[model samples]
Target: MKKICLTIIMGLVIVFLNGCEKVLEKTPDGQTTIDKVLNDFARSKGLIDAAYNEVYQARDQIAFVFSPLESLTDNAFWAATYNPYRWHNGSLSLSDPVITWDWSSPNDQLWSDFWRGIRLANNAIKYLPQSTVITEEQRAEWIAEARVLRCWYYMQLLEFYGPMPWIEEPIEPNYAGWNELVRPGYDEIVTRLESELLDVINANIFKPRVGAVDAKRVTNGIAYAIRARLLLYNASPLNNPENDRTKWQRAADAAQDVIDLPSYRLVPMSEYKRLFIGANTTPVDEIIWRAWTDNSHINNTNGVDVGSYPFASISHMWNCGESPSQELVDAFEMTNGALPVTYNDATHTTVTVTPEAAALGYSEATGGDPYSNRDARFYINIVHNMYNYGVPYNCTEPYIIETFVGGRNGFNDVISQETQRSCPGYYSGKDKQVKYWGPGNSGEGNEPTHWVLFRLAEFYLQKAEALCELGDPDAAATALNVIRERALQPRIQDVPGFANTQEFLRERIRNERRVEYCLEGQYRFIDQRRWKILNETNRFITGMRITKGGNGQFSYQRKKIRDYQSYTDKYLVMPIPLEDAKKMTSMLQPKAWQ
Candidate 1:
């Protein structure tokens, strides 16, 4: 292992790394590196943070326009030229243009990152208990934390690349038969992860919940949350191809376990936006796992950043890196609980709306600003034409987002100097953009935030989806209404035709997830996959082209950004990177990809 000193170990493990350099530090020939590193508690504890660092670094893949996950989904359009856009269309490969040769900094090859994280978590587990300085209580908690963290990374891998080879223990430096492994089935993957987490939960070692002071650490809450999410995905169309009701029931039960946890609850709708950006010393248990940049990679004196893309978009320095899509904006229902628009086809040309909603004055028509009185989450998440952006922390004046033709945030017909020029119609909203610029909002870019991973609202919907699939529509509606009510929208049962059938209720729950988790980490991206609905969500993308009139009113029309046929059957699950897949021999690639 030391001879190769490979950045990625032979198996899916990252044994030694210091920016993939030959040696993180040197020692005498007889002093093996692991022994040197595990000499004390401080160094052993650092291993835990290092594992956490792997996931935190992966967050950069979605930060700004670098390698945004939302760009691959229908939610946001990343128009910057800094990185290749092929990934957005499912063509990112070894030949990808801007990222063709480099996988070091952007860290876009997540397969490596996930395994690196697992290896580190395993390192902590194996070494921490052996440390003389750690007390029994600390040892127990640290072991649980490492196990849960490892499962979290596995969950991510399963979500992205489907089932993987099960590796429980850290690969010893001298273990040589890594290539003998083969990918397991989803059932084995689920059993292994579920059993492992259940073991921890039963051990009663994990903190029931962590305060904002310790928010980033793994807690009992997240183990249940992760298990719920994993099982929910496992029960979805892509993973459960059998339409397994039992799996759905398992998913529902797992989500219920999270709900049973007393500490976690939705931070009121009023606090939703702030929950994503502001620091909370005493968090209200809204978020289950709020991962933050732990100072290993990013430097931030202020609260942790929510990954920095939604900064005041009109600023010259922070140009509109990501333009929220019209498709996503349309998904947000009118505040009165009427869907603003529906499409005859996924291309987004044919639009329709409820005539009842229209008669009551809720409309998506562009006769004027169509963003009025929408879902509470809508206002919290998107910066529309008249919405404020680019405001200074101290300034009394507000800078309105101007995305009309020839406006400050204009439409780009090409790759131009003004990045905002390419904006569709809206920018992502993090109203605290003013406060997140840097230390005390000093116009620098690194602002730390609690950056939510698993949250109560997500579990609500997860429970709803699983219950719906398990043939318990009423119970699912109960969970679904929790989210709807929190968003200040009408309940699912109250929505006219939505309660008429299980299928209708299912669709309603899905749409809630669409808007509720808009532009959030891979939620939309993976949902479309597991639901097997890419034909509907990924066929094409739209940007609202705004033209301003002399009367200072803006007119809008949805324009096709581009059409893609790249979302074929193979894309339901991502293919393992070619370099890594080759080494795994037994599972060269997802069969469809091959």
Candidate 2:
């Protein structure tokens, strides 16, 4: 006889043993006495709460550094401006590096956390079958939620590690051979996710409404969002391009389903900038699903403060960790509906701009607009000439210099110490909380902000991109216009230099995604991977030179140079941390890449 100690608290049961308990346990009733904990409404809620814990754990544990790595590969940031040694200097390794420092490889942690989530979800599924505490419909809904969330966890593994060992069952000691599991191929993982997700979605088991601080918790909309994103990624150029059309079509359809649901809508134009800073709730209209957090033990603050503030905010104000590269900054077309070069062709010759030339609204003698006539999002996201009052220390407010410092009384002297100072053509105001001054005691206050995982706008953009990619120009235009109209930006036809062709539409959709989704943790690198544009444009950086004038004025000039020396195939898929590869034994690096 084996003794199994089962303790039921809330709705969860923990199985432990006094000592050396065998797998076979007999109860006094002559039934197999496996540790069984009955789940009531309270226990179910407790389990749900436990599942939500993974979001915070994932963020603080693995996501912080890993997420930034993706952005660093693209033009979003340079080594010099933020901390230089990390991604910019190529110092980050599977081993040791700088910035959000992590000594252990992220692979195991991410793997463990995701599985932990899966286990909790599995418990929910298993218990839902026999539990009599809740209504049948409610129980079924809970199961659907668990299944969707479980699939989502798997999706994360799929995206990062490629084909991971797929585990649907909760781990038990009886499964002794499970440790010898081998990684599945990409197709196997995809097939399982596709099948499971379809069933989960069709079951319609979740409460239709979004939850509060629980926004980060998995919901039906989130499942749909993940399916759409996964299918789209599979269809994009990054994976096998053979199924590009079919994958994108499925992606579009998934996104459309979310769009059709009245529960989600775009956050109004007025709330756009505030959406990321944690000011607004998941705007019911704009958010489909998000990992929820509140003021409790898991206050869900994201990396926006670390990424946006440039040596100013008190709590986390260091120089901007990920400054937008000149290339990305220039991606925005002039508000006047023309490329910067069209304004003055001569500026194209030089990369740096003299102070005199900069004030005149051009980056260089050749031509670039550092400040004037660009998309609204450009100004909203990139910090250029704005003066940030350093809270209590007003005098310490950093003045952004867009040109080189030189000569008597020049603007350059004001901001010369910062690397890539000349490129501060714009500061990211997106998600900036106005009340946050400088660090604590410096008069700046920090607030509990939530991480927004899903917004309705993202679905719209996803659909638009997919539609355009699938060669449906008109439908793509309609999708894009839906978002644009909400933003109050001119429609495609109303704007000048607009071509409604597929290629043009594609570019337009891409640009829209870049602007709309900047710093929300999605950007060109992922886009490049999905579009298979990494090889063509990954290393390109558009830069400008700044010069000072005698009157202490600063100016910027544009240079049309695409520098690609730093990028390599290894950069495409991050190198498997050497330690992780050694531990796994079977892990292989992505071929023909780095």
Candidate 3:
């Protein structure tokens, strides 16, 4: 009996061991040398795949970085209705200070993650020499792709942190110490990126497929798009020390290069809203480069959650975090090359507030043609009371609104529970999935839509701005007209007010960017910075007074006019994190920041 028991135990042990082997079989071996690990097909692909992974990782975090900056200045969101944590109290230090608060050193995760991407690119470039299986042509293509990614990473850092320490080599602790490092100037970084991008373009290296989605991957078009963007930024007032006209020309040329590519095209006007809603099969012409995500990718679960309204039901939903400001809504021009009549003081001629409109919470009178004679892009991009619920509406130059909620009288408060429903406003429709609904009635789900990082439309807009800045109003007008024609908006005879000069065109271009890129998270503080208008733009709240009535009616009262103050110089470029500053002896804090 004892012998029989031993035999059974040994059999069980063998089964258990076999199961363990299967589980551990694919586990990466630490004993493998770096050279061998890189040469391994799976490992090499994995490392390359990591570059794409960083794209999604970066995309998820982009809102956090951009929201505060965008909110600080007028772009798409209102400052009065939203909390003033970052704007008033300078609490942005809690998240990142490099661009907002001046508490943290520059060596935070923003810098670290950017460098991580750069390092991965470097590793791929370095290992290409050892990759015997990959041909010279193939190797050159791979390296070019990697270089584009590295330039993109650097571009992000350059935009936010200004000049940063240039790192082309993979991190090797044994080879060097942190003391040896120093920050490169903005011009030098731009020059280096431009040089690398030239190689990327000349080599004709990139995935050929038009609609392929890979967040961590770079394509030839993406490289050109990056070059276009970098040159545009470099030509901006922030970076251009000498006011170089050639920089603007370079930007226009780069943008035009991408536009000339047949593989790129704009999405149909009818499908514009659907393109950003969720996983789309139709290839959009506007999207030049996007970080690809599907059901299996990291952060895919939270994709819809991040973009949608945080409400229980679509019908009764309130915007969660991102609320569009009245400023941006007003920026949209009428279809006939004129500002919307809502901005006209004469529109206030009717003054009747209905109970439903009161409950729905809108200060503006209801029943007037709010949607009529408006820009087509406005209807495509924004969702107001009229568009919500089962409202059937036909959008065109003459938009016919069949269903209009919150009529002139009843005011509806649309701020989410996070804000205690105190702030009432229309939500920006740029990122959220329109059809998305949840069990709790919240607008959160795994939205299958890919986030567009670069696009042809933006390139056109950039070229227009650059051309205008370079004293070529005719060229600028032509570029702007291309985008306007696609939008189906009426083209102005001469870019409104800017008949011939670059100065007038520059203003028009800036306004165009605000309208075209609204809620795409572009204008915001960066616009303020580039225009050197940060100090002049408003950034303070007088007081917020709430009045609650017995009939479930609430009112928000504020001072009509209030003075605004700008933060210190240290607030201009975010302060290096204090902890990181301690780690790096060579790091210097922004002036005037503690």
Candidates in order have lDDT scores of 0.66, 0.53, 0.52
Off by over 4 Å in 1: 1-32, 57-65, 81-84, 94-108, 208-213, 294-315, 344-346, 360-367, 389-391, 415-418, 430-432, 436-441, 444-448
Candidate 1 lDDT over 478-594, as tens digits, reads 999998898888887666446556898888889889988875667887898999998777777788888877877666677888665547776677676655555556665666777
Position 403, candidate 1: lDDT: 66
What is the number of backbone collisions in each predicted candidate, taken in the order shown? 7, 50, 38
Model 3's lDDT to the true fold? Answer: 0.52
Candidate 2 wrongly placed segments (more than 4 Å)? 1-44, 56-71, 78-112, 127-139, 174-188, 208-214, 278-284, 294-316, 341-369, 387-426, 438-448, 493-500, 540-547, 557-566, 574-589, 592-594
What is the alpha-carbon lDDT for the whole of candidate 1? 0.66
lDDT of 3 at 83: 33
- Tens-digit lDDT track of model 2 for 1-594: 011122122222221111112233232344322233334465544444454455532222233332333334455543232323334445545543233324443323444455556666676677666665677786777777777777777776555445566665544544444235566666567767878888887866666454454445556678777777777666666665565487778879888987887666676777665555453353545656544443211111221222134555434333333445565665555554333443234333343433333444655332333666556666666655433322333324443333243411122222223332323233344544434444444223544444456678877888888888888888888899888777666676665567878888887788777767775554455676556566556544444445655675555655433334335554445544454455455555556322
Deviation in Å, model 2, residue 130 alpha carbon: 6.0
Question: Candidate 1: worst 10 consecutive residues by lDDT?
Answer: 1-10
